[model samples]
Target: MGQFIISVGREYGSGGHYIASILAERFNVPMYDRNMLDQLAERNGIDAENLYKHEEMKRQGLHRTVRGHSSSVQDSIAQLQFNFIREKAESGESFVVVGRCAENVLRDNPALISIFVRGEEDAKVERISRLYKLNRIEAKAKMFRHDKKRKAYHNYYSKMKWGDSRGYDFCVNSSLMGVEATAEALYSMLSTYLKSKEQ
Candidate 1:
């Protein structure tokens, strides 16, 4: 088996993190998420807290940028993160990365499997409310806010539209069978697809 990569893009409150975890475990590969940014910052002498605070979302014009840089701090950090993702792929390793525009970064890799996970509005609200102990209205608002940020961040950096089915190998609705089943189904589909590719 050659190096394989799975880049998961998910909506907020859609159990994307959990689904990515399940896929990583099933594939027996390491998964990279926001924490990877912290590792990158530590290794490169960048401020991890500042990197995380503005991750995935761009800074507004009024906000102060990272010290000593004329450009947006988020843009610089995003480039570093993209480089890290490419280095990992070039190392001939199989891994999963959630968010961070990884799908676009590795779009040229033949073994890359990009996925976007979304769910029904009501389902997302229910999940968020339960997980955060927030009321349904609050959960819905939070979901909208997060989705907007994610969309903006992705659109700002990538040529493809965020969360669009055409941009991904698979776009699944987790509300139908929940996270566990969705992961399992995707795992099976990927397994078969890889086998077909081998043939």
Candidate 2:
């Protein structure tokens, strides 16, 4: 089997993480998301809590976070994550990585597949509300805030714009087909993508 690195970019509450998990199972490959931070902390001797506090969402705007931390912290963490991503890709294993601009890190890999997953506004709001146990209004506000942060972080780190269809090889409206079906769709498309590479 060919080694493929699948990078998933997504909107808040789009079920991107779940879909990536399913794909990992289908491919029998490891998946990384929040766990990336844990791995980084363990390997680099950084504090896990600090990494969590500054993860993709909060790293973009230093002034907006707690006082005394500068953009330097964000830069170091981002660079570490990118280095880890490249290390994983260099190992030449098939893996599904969610967010943290994995696509940007692995763009030069021949077997890389970048996907952006999104959902309808109302559906995403409902999904987030249920998952986080928040009311619909609160869910919408939370989702909006997260989307803004993610977009800012992604754009700040990568040459491509976040959520831009042109930036990815494929895009999925996960809500339209649901998580399982969306996973199947990605699997099928990835099969074709791999075969085309061989030809």
Candidate 3:
């Protein structure tokens, strides 16, 4: 059997992590998320907390010096994490990687399947609110801010937009389909894709 990879890009409250975890369980594969950051930090000789601090959110435009300093550190950490992703993918372990620009990092690998997960705004807001124990308005605002940061981070390092459908082999709407249904559909899709490639 050949190795497979799934990359999930999702909105802040879209339950992307949950869906990815489900798929990983069903497929009997490892899953990487923030834990990968800790591993990367250890390998790269950087502080894990500092790396996490720069993982999301963009620097404010004010204060040129501050922006430059933060960007440099963030870029270095991103590059190191990218290297770690490459190493993992090459290690013959089939897995699902959540965020950290894994799709962009593994774009050229023939053995990987890239997926993007998104949902309707209302569903996303409700999910975020319930999950984070925030009011609906606060959840909406937080979601917007998180998406903005994700867009900026992705655009800064990749040629493609973060959630753009064209960049992925599969684009799933978890709002309409739900997590279990989405995972089933993705499993079927992966089976077909792998079959076609083998022929």
Candidate 4:
């Protein structure tokens, strides 16, 4: 069987993780997300929490302050994580990897499909508020900040912009279609694509 890698880029509180998990279940494949940090920590002899800290960008005002520093620790951890992602992709196991620039990391691999999941701002705010138990206003502010960091992180490490349709095979709006429906749609699309590749 041909291996497949599905990379999901999502806006916070869009139920992106839920969608990825359901897709992995439907395909009987592994799902990699924050678990990737654990693997990287084990492989590099670093604390997993430390890896998480650098995985996303620092707050907005702090960016300028950290621009010029040569932080070998973060760089080494990122490289190790990239290597681990590549190794997993080449392992012949179909998997869904959320974030971590998996699309860029595995760009050279022809078997990969990159997807971006987004939702309307109001819907995202509602979901975030319920999921995180925050007020609507707080959730909205948090979502905005989170997306900014995610965009900066992706742009800083990869050539593609986060949530940019041009960078992905599919760009889905989960607000219009619920997470379950979105997962099913992606599965159908991916199955068809893989079958054609085999032909």
> Which has the greatest TM-score?
1
Q: Which of candidates 1 and 4 is the stronger one according to lDDT? A: 1
RMSD of 3: 3.2
CA lDDT of each prediction against the hidden true structure: 0.90, 0.87, 0.82, 0.83
Range of the 10 consecutive residues with the lowest summed lDDT in candidate 4: 56-65
Q: Summarize candidate 1's per-residue lDDT along 1-199 as a digit string, tens digits.
A: 6678999999998899899999999989999999888899889898789888888886567644467453767777888888899999999999999998898999998878999999999999999999999999899999999999999999887889999888899999999999899999999998888778777
Candidate 3 lDDT over 8-122, as tens digits, reads 8887777888888988887889899888878887877878898788875444454334544444666666677778789999998889998878888999987878888899999
Candidate 2 per-residue lDDT, tens place, 126-146, comes to: 899999999999999999999
| Colliding residue pairs in candidate 3 | none
Candidate 3 minimal-lDDT segment of 10 residues: 56-65
**TM-score of each model, paired residue for residue:** 0.93, 0.90, 0.88, 0.89
- Show model 2 residue runs off by greater than 4 Å: 57-71
- Which of the predicted structures, 2 or 4, would earn the higher TM-score when compared with the native? 2
RMSD list, candidates in order: 2.7, 3.8, 3.2, 3.4
Clashing residue pair totals per candidate (backbone < 3 A) = 0, 0, 0, 0
Better of 2 and 3 by TM-score: 2
lDDT (tens digit, per residue) of candidate 4 on 1-199: 5888999889998888899998899889999988988877787687888877777552233222266543455555556667778988778778999988889999889878999999999999999998899999999999989998888878877888788899998988998987788888888888888888888
Model 2: per-residue Cα lDDT at residue 165 = 91
Ordered from best to worst lDDT, the candidate numbers read 1, 2, 4, 3
